[model samples]
Target: MKLKTLVGTFALAALPASMSFAWADAAPEMTDAERAQAKQIYFERCAGCHGVLRKGATGKNLEPHWTKTLQDGNKVEGGTLKLGTNRLERIIAYGTDGGMVNYDDILSEKEINLMARYIQQTPDAPPEFSLKDMRDSWKLIVPKDKRPTRQMNKINLQNVFAVTLRDAGKLALIDGDTHKIWKVLDTGYAVHISRLSASGRYVYTVGRDGLTTIIDMWFEEPTTVASVRLGSDARSVDVSKFKGYEDKYLIGGTYWPPQYSIMDGETLEPIKIVSTRGQTVDGEYHPEPRVASIVASMTKPEWVVNVKETGQILLVDYTDLKNLKTTTIESAKFLHDGGWDGSKRYFMVAANASNKVAAVDTKTGKLAALVDTAKIPHPGRGANFIHPQYGPVWATGHLGDAVVSLISTPSEEAKYAKYKGNNWKVVQELKMPGAGNLFVKTHPKSTHFWADAPMNPEREVAESVYVFDMGDLDKAPVQLNVAKDSGLPETTAVRRAVQPEYNLAGDEVWISLWGGKTDQSAIVIYDDKTLKLKKVITDPAVVTPTGKFNVFNTMHDVY
Candidate 1:
């Protein structure tokens, strides 16, 4: 049977029970406050997959439909369908093979139990957010007229890296040239991704809590000038990169409310809100088709907005916001994160749950190709480089498979017309030591490819990063012990290595040693030439740094 059919059947079987099951009698009950806390936790942690409405897309359906009590008062139990509280708790604690990370290390036992119970109850529909709500919550702390006309500091804006200190609810601005932390500014909880304006003057950060902050780098202190709340939960944010609309507008994608919000780029005054709830490419009406990623087209005055559940890529014309025009291209389901190809004309996004990478030709506004890939391809702005044999290829690391898939992309350049036959094909699959990888990175000037397996539950794999030589694709990756190389004392907890980012010159690569909230986390730097550890940045304030984006690379979409 197809996965979608299986999912539908599973969801239908889990409908809420009219009478309480026998397991509820033995299960520990929660107070009103605890229940509320559990709901919040679910929104922050589980909503991205299971969805705000508990209708599964990338993740399994978590509604109470699976835990309904039978006429005999027994909980639902059948082949591969176990809805008991104990089974639910174990799944939450240990995670499944479907790319869900183990929460045992991230959440407490009590919280896990609460979440297990929370899913058994009927799902709640979050309050809808409108343009008025966004406008009311918008705050312009510093007007554009009051902002500096010229660069106020000597810091090289291109070399500055915006690092997300996830658990700390802060963004650490680090000088990539000097490898030093410049400033740590407060932001929303677990800022998803930091985006740079077209001119590279402003840094925009949207958090999981739906808070978006616009930071002006021209300020002497590099502080946030404007802020607004998109909704309750958001993941992606991007500014207009087209010539006419350079930094004129900003767009944010929210997981909850299933909507996207557009605001003034300078002041963050929300102008419009569009709901993504509609029929998916599969011809099914999905209620929770969250906007996953939005990338501005460099060749056209448009934004490629990827709707996660619907598997529809909407090329939204930003030329006229009042009367917006969109061209929809159907692809695979669960479109998450992606990046531009080497030519920047083709935008490739990972439809992770479907195990496919959908490449769209932004210049033509059409679906370029849909290439099959390994399971759960979670590429955070996937790596792009010229393959030795193939003309150009994009790299994506997988979470459910032990391989890094390199796909050949078509190029319009006249110099390389012979390799056009390999376009939109999986040319190679580099074997990694293990699965569970979130990011794969390569700089234009670097000959090495870096990938981190932080999502892997195994300590050895999670604590290490693999580096592959671009000169030879057949050789195995050199495993670097990132946690041990951090020069910090070993702990029982796994300090996962993640997010390899390059400096402006691509001479050095930085990896984050993500430890527990209370433990000391460090950003370990390595010399790209020698593949040797250079420096380990650890401080009290650098807590749980996950993703570090270089200003020059991010602004230009180098990767």
Candidate 2:
């Protein structure tokens, strides 16, 4: 049992029974450098939704048996929980209608009472990365017949951009027709999503520290030919975009062993790991159900996969990964991130703690609607558009509502058959001047739709970026400060503009000014027909720049 002592014995079996005599009777109210600065602010903002063994998928279970459970059944000698510490510091300074974000404008009240007494202490356990520790952290490094088969780089693999240099574990690869920076590399750690390979000549990425990599933009400088590691946290990755499997299998998912893996799209190897725990689609029993947002179904070689704490979507079937059928379906509950509707046959997603969105269809693999949205929502790949008067909608954006809803998607043409009686319904909400939001984009030859609150904590709506007007969806959007159009220099901390994308000639949009990691970040771009600011892209290796994508709209996932 030495896979680093079996991941430190599964993080000490995720501590519970008197976690060290309740942290030795709450160790003198915090002093070992304030519990090491509250475990580095719970590993940079609460271990990505209450985890690192606090065992809750998409947030909530701060263990110590539910954050110290105490309506007075006596506990709190450091195992603090009768929901106290002023109701978990007012749910970490006002934020939690589930999509949890109001760190009272980014933590302070002494870092939200030191992360509400650091999740009521007792939660360290972080080591189990098995699958022979991801095949002993695999690495190939340039092997598909020593790479470069064709385009040995004149760079413009459909306007290359894949930026996510998040917390500098790196990815950069810029140059969307020379907005510059073209290659940063070294990944895995906050890389979250990049995924291209439907013959965009490989990009892949996927990291919240589960690594993944791949790269090879027909080399001669694009590099990193292969890499692996899909456990110990991860976000999502795709690849096998059907049509005789273009990149031939890749998958990924993970947020800590709630499994997904499936490799070898071009030698990252590990072929199959599955396990998205059990029960949930509300049938209960979910021991961290996660495998959130996977996609890859351009009309089925199958992979829809969602699952966040078991709202169960699955579909899977990679044409027999040694006989693997799948097809689960059930919807709603924390699912997270979505897209594909201007008829890529449905597929929606965001169950964001159940404010619901769910969709599916993928050409009738079923569960096609769920709908009802607003609070939380957070649709990272959402925005489908064609709606001057609601004739094929699909939009999302919310972290606890302020509007942008949209919906309506279902059609058999005939000029959208009078809006098909508002198909999956909700038609229009739009509003937004607030609410946290995480991506909403749009561009099928544009008319403007973009969203992005960068998880709003307000510093002028998280450094602004709204822009509606698909010929006026009842007006009112054009916000745009994008950190004052990224001319950068306004820090009261929130330098977050975040992901807009669109360029394979949608005449520019780009965005990402996400600052911090020695802040200076920039990507801005704009000008999608006079929405203005066309290019700011500051450098010093444009460090913390989150999500950019666009290798021809992420090899045609298009949102």
TM-score for each candidate, following the candidate numbering: 0.93, 0.32
List model 1 lDDT by residue over 94-117, tens digit each: 666556667777789988878877
TM-score for candidate 2: 0.32
Q: Give me the candidate number with maximum lDDT.
A: 1
Compared with the true structure, all predictions reach lDDT values of 0.87, 0.77
Residue 288 accuracy (lDDT) in model 1: 82
lDDT of 2: 0.77
| Superposed model 1: Cα runs more than 4 Å off | 1-29, 67-81
Query: How many clashes show up in model 2?
Result: 3
- Provide the clashing-pair count of each candidate structure: 4, 3
In model 2, residue pairs whose N, Cα or C atoms come closer than 3 Å (at least 3 residues apart or on different chains), thus clashing, are: 68-81, 70-82, 376-400
